[model samples]
Target: MKLCFMMLTDLSKRFNFMNSTFQMANGYFEKHEKDLHQLSDQIWDNPELAFKEKFAHDLITDFFIEAGIGTVTKNYILDTAFKVEYVTGKERSDSTISESDLPCVAFFSEYDALPGIGHACGHNLIAVVGIASFLKLCSSLKATGTPARVILLGSPAEEGGGGKIKMMNNEALSGVDFSLMGHPSALNCCTSTITQAMEEKRATFHGKNAHGTTPWMGNNALDAAVLAYNNINTLRHWMHPSMRAHGIFTDGGKAPNIIPDRAELLYYFRAPDKKQLKPLLERAEQCFKAGADATGCTVEICEKSEAYDSVIQNPVLGRIYEKHMENMGYQFPPKDEKTFRGSTDMGDVSRAVPAIHPWFLIPCGGAPGHSVPFAKAAKLPQSFKNAMDSAECLAKTALEVLQSKQLFDEMKRSFKETCG
Candidate 1:
């Protein structure tokens, strides 16, 4: 029989925990489940915005330091970003451990929440999965006498600030072989197997203002805004089916009676990947410029946040992850039915290194993500259970990669093919 990839259909198949390391990893996560739940709750209770996750930053650092699991860096590169490193079997080694001799696996944690809708995206649970997996992986490696390095990166401001990009620019991900993280998703209706490449642009129209009665004397910036909106609407009809373009007029005008001098809008452009997104962005610029030309107004366009590349799904690592998730009782939908949920900074990370950001099912009772209902569901007890399951699987995936050079090379080959 021809096989594309096995989805861990049978518990006794590839996912058998007979491997002592995998078994030990599972035990480690099970023992730390309670602490993981509390950490999730505390972060959920205190929702901080992008680049200001001080509470989460402090809490997570303290958790690692008190446990003595790794060497913790309080403020890593960014104020809200932190890093934890643990070398398995380091204490038992008589000679100095050469970092070059060991393969490194990094896990990312995002703690920033929505502006007002706290934990709407279940980022608190994401922290649990990342940290928990890192800890579990460390424990298993130590128990098995494996020489490896593990890292946990506390990334901030994913809501719109693109914290991962900031870390990438700072070379914070340097020396890491690959990265992994799991996210919670309750939206059963239209969840994508992978996310899209996304970018934000702010357009401003400059014109002269005049009294309401003498509107002709002034170039109405609001008119420019409306025209631009319409132009983009027309452009959408010709856009690629996978591409998405939408925006809101943040500054429509001061008063209805005045011919506004300035107007502003915020729009997002999404494509399957960064390469396709570039042309779409260029075309949108023309639409905005046309709107200004028609009204004899000048325009300025600026990017609001860092651009996010589409995720390069590494099939090799994906199969490793699928094997475990399936063993944990999560079923995968047919590939054709997979839906696009939205965009994320993790997209950028995938392009940089072999990475997986699987969206695990959470108990949201059919509530769409980022909603008040979804936010409430994020803290549900079952949600943590689901989160820990992912953590266990992640650690197992790490163990397999660290133990086999051939597998790591194959994973990297897949990354090259997908990224190239």
Candidate 2:
């Protein structure tokens, strides 16, 4: 009890610091709340799938330009990827300015909607929060001081496009000191746990096609594909509890009577971490080979994208952000009882840098994310306020990261050690 009280007291002091800074700059976000919610709702109304977010991309990029942040590149690393940068320094006020000493903080925004379920994942709120953070930060910096660099990354196709991986390969996030984003969930302060045990790998298999009725006359690739799936299912019981493998039949056959010579299956194998995941993947590959050999079918396996290593949450940064959240009157439940069943490209970022993907609560009576109920809740008045709150919290959190040299150093060290 005594220890808990002391921790809360210290947290209160930090919270007080965040609130003072935010209050002076809150008006900008407050005045823009209606516009923010409307933008979010507009995204909900026009849901676009992965790699095809033309409508979403145009709306958000236009808004960023209107705010004076000018888009840097569109279709940057992918068909729908883009980046917007806003750089400021004390030297900018005078005639002399040197760019070498500025620290760059990046804000990542994902706006792709799920197929057949527009904004069902609340990406609308996600987009607004990113903009809200930029707006508040701009207002705060105008009166007080400016940070080194503020980057608004408009990463598209997070639904399944692996947009961040593409951006990373292009060296787009090279100079970013830290990246931050918030995800809406059933509760606030949902801390992330590092699942360094297994990694996820995507593989696809292909085989020749033939007439279905005269199956013996030609190779039935679909049969070979089924055999591979059965092999994986049979092996599941013998594997570790954490081991998981599943696949979708992308090409079962052309017609019922035709011995479809070509068939395809996309499979994913996950283990606690890369070391364990590697062998499992190799073993799964052998199963596919065996299936092809048995059914007289040819096989082809393509890795969909790079494996996402486990997350490494920065505790110091998390606690600081948590304090700011609690100061803002947010309460979090215990992690053991909370449930988060989805994954993110941010997990890849966490593996590479000191990061945190904290959950903020928006009411749905324990509704699951990416569901119809959650989607409806996302448009509610409360949901918009949560978006406002998320913006304030993330901006305040970024300010803390910028102002505290000691904390900033600790985060960098932690990232090096964890990623190494």
Candidate 3:
């Protein structure tokens, strides 16, 4: 009976600690709810393309500074990128615990909007939730005397530029123990489905120009471009169902009467993993070469951007997030259910450190992503509610990691075992 009493008492203390921490987080969010909503709405109103989010960069940075939060603008050598850091428990620290031993957790926010459609991917919501979560976590840590470090990374150009990839290369995540972010989607999921690795290439064909009357005098670059497109279409028959190869003709020809000297085709290659993506890329290149051979033209293929690796989810961290989200009345689909298949630079971050990029639901009135309807739905009341709930979930999960060394270690172990 004494042993039982001890166990119950310990459990009660833990429960109370967690409850107080959550209450503090809730209070922070409630206090700043209006400002966060305005930030989200303002970002949505002024949509900026990749690497050109000056307005968003200034808005968020100024907010942090005015609130007395430590911020580093133009972080990782990117003009639009920034970082916010908050530390607590230094004065109340236990003599036994060293400052260097505290775990550092990171949250990523992406604010760049898509061309023509503006926030069609709900990146505005992502930025708001990320900032709110970071603020709440900072407040919770200070109020509870928890010795922890929080970081919020303002990542840009996730649409195509791979800003996170550049940041990782610059050692921006050097001391981060874990990275967390959530994307807006039609379904709520703790783990995103396996995203295919992507490689973009541009093939330019060079040939001599000639008049239409003397076609024999010119090697038609347009013919080479057409052949390349056809070659890819034929290769698709032998490709895996998950593998995809698609291209667009950027320059077909000058005119019908004059044979063009140059033609260019841009192609995107995707596969289940980098290992599989390599051969597919090689095969696609061969198709381009075959076009050049048949048309008597020379071809140059250049990679458009760095390859995006498939996401390797850390299930240990995912379970903690799943529990918090479930407690918030969010229901996720079964694991076997198809998750939205989309590539992100966060995939690269996951491979580098323990990371979680869960998806939160935003009702789109039956519209899919990258659509006008979806962009409009980002401002709906339901979307804001979902964002706030997701923020709370992320904060709760981060608190668990900060307070429990065993849990943090397990997360790292799971990441190494599954990702490495």
Q: What is each predicted model's overall lDDT from 0 to 1?
A: 0.82, 0.70, 0.83
Candidate scoring better on TM-score of 1 and 2: 1
> Candidate 3 local accuracy as lDDT?
0.83
Pairs that collide in candidate 3 are: none
TM-score of 2: 0.87
Give the higher-TM-score candidate: 2 or 3.
3
Which lDDT tens digits does candidate 2 get at residues 47-123?
88888888878887776666555346667677777787765535433334333345667777778888665777888
TM-score of 1: 0.91
Q: What shift in Å separates residue 410 of candidate 2 from its native position after superposition?
A: 2.0
lDDT tens digits, residue span 129-236, model 3: 899889778877777766667889999888778889988888889778888888888778767467778888999999889999999999999899899999999999
| Model 1: per-residue Cα lDDT over 1-420, one tens digit each | 001011112212333332665665555556667888999999999999999999999999998788777899988989999999987654444345466445688999999999789999999999999998898898787766666778999999888889999999999788788989998986321123868899999999999999999988999888898999999999988898899998999997888899999999899999988889999999999999999999989899999998888776677777888788888778877657757767889889988999888878887877877899889988999998888888888888877876665677888888888787
